[model samples]
Target: MDKVLLKYAEYNEPHESCTNTDIVDILNKKHSAMKPAASGSSEDTEMMGD
Candidate 1:
């Protein structure tokens, strides 16, 4: 998702358009319907120092 936004901003010219908060809100709404990953996986445990 971050990559997508970076690429969009990189290729597109800057203008008086959406702000950072606007982009965050848009991404949040777009992804909010998706299910999150499961907890307690090995990667997650390692990241949490558990």
Candidate 2:
């Protein structure tokens, strides 16, 4: 999870309106949606080798 999300979850811990699980679920969905494309350029792969 991201630091901002983690902080938000922590802040919500004392509130009755939101739960940690809810925050986690939202974070998961956000992360999946923000995932990078599977295909990488040749330059990207070459940099990985170094």
Candidate 3:
């Protein structure tokens, strides 16, 4: 889930010493933490490293 966390960080930078659980908690609180990429989207490959 590093990709997800990294993407999340782009929108909101977390504490320097935060752990993975901390990052997930931050996302959980937001509710809309992530959404699936659109079809035929190049961004999906670029950002997701597909």
- TM-score for each prediction? 0.35, 0.40, 0.31
User: Candidate 1 overall Cα lDDT vs. reference?
Assistant: 0.72
Tell me how far the alpha carbon of residue 47 in candidate 2 is from the true structure, in angstroms, after superposition. 14
Ordered by TM-score, highest first, the candidates read: 2, 1, 3
lDDT of 3 at 1: 94
lDDT scores for all predictions?
A: 0.72, 0.73, 0.68
Model 2 per-residue lDDT tens digits across residues 11-38: 5456556689999999998877666543
Q: How well is each residue in 1-50 modelled by candidate 1, as lDDT tens digits?
A: 99878765855666678899999998997676443543336568888895
Tell me the tens digit of each residue's lDDT in model 3 across 15-43. Answer: 67888999999888665534333434767
Off by more than 4 A, model 2:
1-16, 36-50
The model with the greatest TM-score is 2
Q: Which ten residues in a row have the lowest lDDT in candidate 3?
A: 31-40
